[model samples]
Target chain A: MKKLYTLIKNDLKLIVRDKTLLSFLLLPPVLIIAFKFLTPILVETAPILEEYRVIIGMFASIQTAIMFGFVTSFLILDEKDENVMNVIRILPISGFYFILYRLLFATVFSSIAAYAMITLSDIAHPGNLEAILLAILYGMTAPTISLAISTYAKNKVEGMAYFKGIDLLLMLPIASFFVGSSLSMVFSILPTYWVFHFYETSYNDAPAFEFFAVGFCFFGILISLLLFQFRKRVFGR
Target chain B: MIHTKDLYFKYPGAAQNTVNGISFDVGAGEIFGLLGPSGSGKSTTQKVLFKLLSGYQGSAQIKGKEITDWGKELYSQIGVGFELPNHYLKLTALENLAFFQSFYDEGLDPMELLKMVGLEKDADKKVGEFSKGMKMRLNFVRSFAHNPEILFLDEPTSGLDPSNSRILKDIILDLKNQGKTILITTHHMEDAEELCDQVAFLSEGEIKKLDSPENLKLEYGKRTLEVRTYGSNEPVIFDLDQLKDDKSFLELVQSGEIKTIHSKEANLNDIFIATTAKK
Candidate 1:
């Protein structure tokens, strides 16, 4: 627990010091604020946002998952680039524990953003436990997928390209919302599809499947990353 | 506490081993230098000993066991101060040390270590703001934070001014006096001379020569004497083949006209060239 705290603290310190990363982290909240007001104006004319206000809030929350994922991957990559990981690997604790802490940072921060967006966007009841919990799950897994993609990124610039290229995958689950249930299976192949599906199905009938789907997506992304590490040497083995 | 026998390491998919069939030992409380130019496997050997590179043939032992056998516990006993001085650029010097200190449960006081390296004043300053020399000094004492019995210092004094180098050397000697074993790998032969109790000259992944600096000088040194007279601007060299019967040499010395007279022996650079053949 102490080691995890120290690692998380260290990561936070690094993120705060890095201007590029700080901006990425701050972007979600700023956009949520901008969208909070602009969204009201847009809903007046656009009939779609009035019915899909929860999705609009989900958009703000989900952007955090994307940003945090980029932050997590590049943070790990930066450690390698600076060769500090070599110093870190020799620490008394297992180096793999640091990866856990990074993932912890990802999920925790994304959850906070989800809750924060839900409250600020005023699209739903902030006290809605199931809705906020679903928001958190959706927020958490997007970065988890991004984190997995970053593991394959050879360097920072490549990590950025990977982040941008895979950014489209996050919208797939949301896009499936308008296209009807026929496209749901295709999007469900992506881990993020479960997250978007949970939000889409949360207000209507059959909330239990959507809830299980989100959990499955979160664990699925993790299990696949575990398999990746097992099959190939990574983190500079 | 370090011993290697027939050590060999080849990177993945490489044609040949970077460190091939080499061996050496560094005893407790001794400074052993691994000397070589780039691509000669000095770094590779250090990496193998430090367990940074594995999958090598032969043996490297730390504290009576194979290097690979020792894990995180091995790190506790063996400290490393790298050449380039990597640190969290955002963290203050104190924060960085304290952060690393959290990784070790044993004896450590980050402030004292910082003060020992004259970095206590800049303890609050971010490492990114530090000069290169300050960074190097901070890195040198970082090894001390873990209270390791053996230290693996890769080019300990790589990019420091003479004064800072002397300061660092003095601190290393202090550690030696306190019974810490240190292994230093450097291309600076003079560093090997001044610091190492024994030095190994490596070339093309093989040990070309291994001896104390003094012994190497004696073995490869020129067996000659030179003297300068008041009239001559240049010294006259004479072989020590029959020094007693050399009439002119004796006359110049006896007449007290010899401006300087000393045996011509090898400095470390001279011996380095003689052994490594200017590779």
Candidate 2:
């Protein structure tokens, strides 16, 4: 417990010192404020946007989660750039445990940020239970981004390029809402599609449990695979 | 406290072993040096001993237990100072020490460690702003901040000025007096001569020669002496074995006319070159 506290505290200091990461601390409140004011204006302007307010709300929350994921991934890239992991490998704490702790920290932060974005936006008007489930699913996005960046990118320059590509993939789930259910299944291979499917089914009063189960399984498998690649490439395990 | 027998290590997919059939023991309170040029397996041997690299086909023990049998607890008893200084560059020196200190149950005070390395005044300053020598000094002391029983230092004095190097060497001697075994890998012959109780001249992943500094000099040095008397521009050379039977040599010494008398003993640089040179 003491070791974990120390590690987290050290990470916090690094975050505060980094200008790029410091901006992420304000990202949630800034985006939330922007969404709060802009949603009603968009509805007033198009009136067709009224039908897509829930999707807009969902986009806002997922975007917040993705941004938090970027924060954590950049933190990891900073450590890799400085070769801090090599020093940590010799310590009593295992490198896997340290990474687990970072993911957990990011998950909690992203979950809370997503929940705040969802509840404050007035567009996604979800029930308490649905909101909790969506928040949990959104939280998983943080670690997925962290693992993907660590596995594929060697430094921050490459991380930025890889992250832009990943951002395009994360948005693929939005295409499912426009297409039919049978056609939407084509996007099921992506983990984010299932997350959006769970939200869509619950909002439409359809069976949501299967989507939740499939979403979690995909999240589990993708996270596991990414973790494996991350361990092998980053630590040479 | 450390022992290895016929240790051999070959990297995965490599053609040959990097550490090949080498054996040595480092007792408690002793300093052992693995001296070699690049690619001589000095770092590889240290990695195998520290459990960083596995799949060795020989017996290796640390503190009387097989290295493979030990867990992460082994790290608490053994500290490693890498050849490159690895620190959280954005964090202050004090914070860096405190963060690493949290990994162990007990560690020396961060302030004291910084003071020992002459970085106390810069404790609050970020490491990224430090000079290479300052970072190297900090890297040297960080190895034993946990007060480990054994220390592995690679190029500990590399990149330091003479004054700083002397300070680090003095601290190492102090640690030795406190009964901690130290293993150092360096290319600097002066470091090997001044710090090591025993040194192994490693070349191409093999131990070519191993002995004390004095003994190596005796075994490989010239068996003669040179004498220069005042008023004579030319020096005279005599066989060291027959110096006592040479009247002229004795007469110059007895008459107090000898300006300088020097024995031709090999230094570690000459010995290192001679031993590691391809036969």
Candidate 3:
């Protein structure tokens, strides 16, 4: 338990010191705020812009999810490149504990970012508590999927390559929403798809709770298994 | 205590074993040095002992039990410092130490460790800003922070200045005196000569010679003496064996004509080079 706390604390210190984290966590929130205020002025003069709120909201959620995914992937890749895993492996702590810390950190950071984005946009005004909780749940899943992909990555460059490839595949489900298709069944298989579905349904008049619960349970198990397999292969017991 | 018998390790796709079927024992509180050149399997030996690499072919034991039988509990008693300094570059030196110190049950004081390594003033500086020597010193302190019973240090003094190197040597000696078993791997003959109780010369994944520095030197050194004398305005060399019982040799020595007289005893470097070169 102490070792896990140390690892998590160390990671948090580094994350706080990183300039990139600022750009990653703050930039999207700032952009959403800018778009929120700018849309009113532009839409008053141009009637075509008034009907694009839902599209903008979807775009915002997708953008937020991708940013979250990139941040989680890059963080794991950085640690791997620095041989931090090797250092951690020599410690008396279990692999499960080390991974749990990382997952928790990523989830908390992602949740904060999600809440900030929603609060800034002011379009989907779910109460602060519901928004925070839903974001936390969704945020936790991103890092698991990203970390699982990182297992096959040998270095940062390769990890980024795989991350981008996976991002494209994941974006397919989000893209389904823009096309006005009800493809929750297909999106159910992709963890990010459920995250997007959860966000869209929570604020708008849609069935998000049922989809969120089912998607959370399903991906939760799958990702846990994938994380275990990864931990075994990369850091043998 | 460490014991290995017919231990073998080969990296995947390698043609020959990186570590051949070699056997050795390191007793408690012993300073065992693995002396070898690059790619001579010294580091590989240390890695195996530290459980960094697995899938070996033979038996290895630590603390009177097989390595395969040991659990995470074994790590609490062991510490490793790699050839290269492994630290978070963005973190201050203090933060780095504090982070690793938290991994162990009993840890040395980070401030005292930094002071011992002569990095006390730079504790707040980021490790990325440190020079190679500074980084090496910090690496030395990191190994001792856990107060481990067994220490595996690879090239511990590779990049330090003389004074800092001496400090590190003193710390290693101090640890040894405290009854800690230390395994040090280095190509520096002087380190083995000055610090190790027993040194092993490794080449091509095999130990060429293993013994105390004094014993190895005595065993391999020449028994003859070399006498240098000024004769007719020129220096002349006389072999001790050639004048063993000669009256003229005594007369020469008594007349003070000899400029210098010294036995030809091999140093640790000579023995190391000769032994490893042969293999």
Candidate 4:
């Protein structure tokens, strides 16, 4: 427990020191706000402005998640490239605990970024406790997927490549303006797509418990297993 | 303590074993050095000892039990300082130490360790701003912050200037005095000569020679003296063994004209090069 606290503290210190955190955490939401203001200028029609607002807002949320996910991957890759992983590997700590510490750190950062985006856009405020809980749940999924991707990357450069490719595909559902709304059903399998769905659906009314619970359980199980396999294959006993 | 017998390790897709059948033992409070050139399997041997690589043929015992039998408990008693500095550059030096020190159930005081390595003044400075020598100095003390009973140090002084190297050497010797068994791997012959009580010369996945520095030198050295004397305004060299009991040799010595005399004993470097070069 002491070790976990130390790891989390050190991770937080490092994150705070990074100059890129501002661009990563704040820039996406700022860009979304800018787009929201410029929507009328780009499209003088109210119908087009409404469509643009929804598309930009959805894109903003996913951009936030992907940005935060990439940050987590870069951090883990940096540790691996610097041989910090090897140093910790020789310690008395279990692999499970090591990864848990990283996951916790990433989750905290991603949550902050997610909340900032939600506030800036003022689009979908999940006011109730259940809605808020689901938002937090959505935020936690990004880091787990990021950790899984990092396991396959050999270095920072490769990690960025993987992040870019994966982020591009994951961000596709938000491109509904260009790709057509017919594709949303196809892309809904992606976690970010579900995040957008949950955000849009929650404001109308509390989502059906079955919808949130089932989606949460499925992604949760998948991420848990991915985290386990990543720990075993990349960081062997 | 460490014991390995017929240990073998081959990298995936490699044609031959990186570490062939090699056996050695490190007793309590001993400094054992594995001396070799680059790609000579010195690092591989150390990796196996630390259980970093598996799929080896043979057995290794640490602290009187098979290494495979030891669980997470083994790591609490061992510390490893890698050749490359492994630190979070964005973190202050103290933060880095504090972070890693927390991983162990038993950890040394970070302040005392930082002070020992002369990093106390810069404890709050980010590690990215540190020079290579300073980084190495910090890395040296970082390994011991867990108060490990055994240590594995690879090229402990590779990047340091003479003064910093001396400081690190003193710390290593101090660790020895405190009864911690250490295994050091390096291509630096002088480091091995000065620090290691017992060293093995490795080449091409095998040990060419293993013994104390003094013993290896005695075993491979000529054991004869070469004398230089002035003969007709020119220096003449003669082996001491060749002039034994000769009247001329006695006359030259009695006349007090010997310019220089040196024993033909080899230094550790000479022995290391000679033994490894043969393979």
Candidate 5:
């Protein structure tokens, strides 16, 4: 536990000191704040269609999760390129703890980022505590999955390319709503589909237990893929 | 403290083995050096001993147990200083040491170690701000922070100036006096001669020669004595075995005309070039 704390503390210190990464993390929150003020004006000037406000809220939360995942990937790639992971591998501490710690941090950061975006955006707030908690849970998987897939990238440049590419695709689910039901089957495979669907359906009203269950089901798949890919790519076993 | 038998290793998908058949032993409380030019399997041998690389064909044991069997617990018993400086750049020197020290259940005082390496004044300085020599000094001292039974140092004095290099060698000797076993890898023959009890000269993944520096010199050096006379600028050379009986040798000694006499024993650098034949 002490070793784990040290790893997290040092990692956070390194992240804070990294100007590029600090900016990467700051961007999502900045976008959320932008939407917070912009949403009222957006709502006032736009058509009677209130659904775009929900899109803005989901955009902020989802983008926060995605950007933060990119942040985590950047640090991981740095550690790998610097051979810090190999240095730590020789320690009495298991290297698994490093990966495990990142996983937990991603979950925690995503939840916090999600809550701030939803509540501060003030447009698509979950009506109840359960839904709020569920929204946070949904927020956890995007970055987790994103960082997992990012393990394939050899360095930060490649990681950025991967992030920008995948993040652009994550927008597919948001656009799928506009394109109507015809494209739902093609977009449904993405984790962000459930991410967008969760907020779109539950903005003002409390979602059913089954709705939360489906979100968890998608999270389970993402978490599985994450573990399997991490084991294959970064672990090289 | 370390034993390897016909060890062989190949990188993934490489055409040939980076570490070919080689074997040697180092006793407890001894400083053993693996000396070679770059890419001569020096670093590979060190890595095998430290358990950083795997998939070897032969056996390697450290402190009497097979390296493969030692697991993570073995790390606490040994410390490694890689040739490359691997500190977290943004962290202060003290912070880097303290953070890594926490990984071990037992530790020496990091500040004391920093002080030993003359880094105490710069403890609060970020590693990124450190000069290469300062970083090298910090790297050398960090391996001792855990007080491990064995130390693996790969080119511990690389990039260090002569004064700092001498200082580091002094501390390394001090660690030896404390009964710590060390495996050092370097192409620096002077360091090997100064510090190593036994050294292996490696060439292209093979052990070309292995012995103490003195013994290797004795075997390869000319068995002659050079006597310099005051009047003549040139020195006269005599076979060592004939020195006592030869009238000229004794006459020069008694005549007080001899400026200097030196046994023609080879230095480590000369022996290294001859043994490895690496330019």
Candidate 6:
């Protein structure tokens, strides 16, 4: 626990020092604030848009999760660029645990941010337990995308390209609502689709228990596969 | 303190083994050098010992346990200094040490370690701003920050000037005095000659010669001595074994007319070249 604390403290220091990463760290809050203010204005300007607040809220929350994942991915890439990963592999705590801690930290931070964004935006009024579960389910996207970017990208430049491409794809699940029923079912393969569906069901006064179960299974399988790939590629384990 | 016997390893999809059937032992309180040019498997051998590489065939032991048998705890027992300087460029020198030091249960003071490497003044300066030599100094000192019993140092003086090189060598020797076992991989023949008690000359993943520097020099050196008389600019060579019976050489020495006499000993560079060239 002490070692994990030390790692977290060091990462916090690194994030605070790097301006680019600091901006990413600050982006989620800015996004939440922007959504909080902009939603009411849009509701006032076009009362018809009031019914689409859930869609608007989905953009902020999901984007916030993606942003957190990218932040952690950039940190991993920085460690690689600096060749500190080699030094880290020889440490008593080992590189595997260090990365595990990063992924978990990103997941937890994104969950809290998602909760804040959803509740503060006043777009979704689910009970506390339901809201927390939905936010936590959405949060799994953090580690999934984090591992995906860091696993495939060899450097920060490549990481940015992957981040942008994955960012656009993550938002694609929302497009399922505009498509035919059969086409909508096709989006279920994407882990984010279940997250989006779960949020949609919960906010619309329906039990999202089924979406939560499916999302957990989808994220679990994808994350496990990515973790294996990450270990093989980065640590060569 | 460390032992390897017929150890072999091949990289994935490689044509041949990078470390092929090499073996050696390093006793406690001794500095053993693996001297070779680049691509000669010096670093690969070090990696196998430190558990960075796996699927290696044959046996390697650290402190009486097989390297494969040991887990991450093995890292706590050994320190590694890589050939290249690897540090958090944005972090201060002190921060880098402090961060690495936090990995161990107990570690030496970061400031004292910085002082040891003459990096105390630059402790607050970010590593990206450091010169190559300064980073190399920090790399060398960081290996033993946790006070490991064994050290693996790869090109410890690679980027340093002569003064700094000498300082690092002195510290290595000091570590030897303190009963620490050190394995160094360097292409610097001068370092091998001065610091190593025993050196293995590696050529294409094979040990061409393994012996003390003095013994190798003696074995490969000329079996004669050169004497220069004060009056003559020309020096005369005499067989070393017959020095006692050479009355003229003795007379020259007795008359104080001998300007200098030196045994024709082969230097480590000559020995390395001659040994490796054989392959």
- Compared with the true structure, all predictions reach lDDT values of 0.78, 0.88, 0.76, 0.76, 0.81, 0.90
lDDT of 1 by residue, A2-98 (tens): 8878887888889998998899888878876887788878888887768887667656667755777778877888876666777877777777777
Query: How well does chain B match by TM-score in each candidate?
Result: 0.94, 0.96, 0.92, 0.91, 0.96, 0.96
| lDDT score for candidate 1 against the true structure | 0.78
Residue-level lDDT of model 3, residues B73-164, one tens digit each, is 77887888878877888899999888877867798889999999889999999998999899888888887798888999999999888898
RMSD of 6: 2.3
Task: After the best TM-score superposition of candidate 6, give how far the Cα of residue A190 lies from its true spot, in angstroms.
Answer: 1.6
- What candidate 4 gets wrong by more than 4 Å, as runs, is A26-45, A51-54, A108-137, A152-162, A175-189, A193-229, A232-237, B105-111, B230-246
- DockQ for all models, in order? 0.67, 0.73, 0.53, 0.69, 0.64, 0.74
**B183: Cα error in model 5, Å:** 0.5
**Residue-level lDDT for A106 in candidate 4:** 61
lDDT by residue for model 6 over B1-279, one digit each (tens)?
Answer: 999999999999999999989999999999999998889999999999999899999999999999989988999999999988999888899999998998888788899988888899999999999999999999999999999999999999999999999999999999999999999999899998899999999988999999999999999999899999889999999999999999988888889888889999899999889988743
Clashing pairs in 2: none
Instruction: Tell me model 4's lDDT, rounded to 2 decimals.
Output: 0.76
What would the per-residue lDDT of candidate 4 be over residues B177-279, giving only the tens digit for each residue?
9999999998778888899999999989898899999898888888576667765555555555777777776777899888887777788899888988853
Candidate closer to the true structure by DockQ (higher is better), 4 or 6: 6
- TM-score-wise, the better of 5 and 6 is 6
Lowest summed-lDDT stretch of 10 residues in model 4 chain A?
A123-132
lDDT per residue for candidate 2 within B1-279, as digits (tens), equals: 999889899998999999998999999999999998899999999988888888987878899998899888999999999898888989988888888888898899999999987899999999999998998888887889999999999999999999999999999999999999999999899989999999999998899999998899899899999998897999989999998899988888889888898999999999989988877
Candidate 4 residue-wise lDDT, A119-178, digit = tens: 555544555554455556556667655776778888877876787777787667565435
Model 1 residue runs over 4 Å out of place are A26-38, A54-58, A115-133, A142-161, A178-189, A207-223, A226-234, B277-279
Worst 10 residues of 3 chain A by lDDT: A54-63
Best by lDDT: 6
Q: How far is candidate 3 from the true structure (C-alpha RMSD, Å)?
A: 3.8
TM-score comparison, 3 vs 4, better candidate:
4
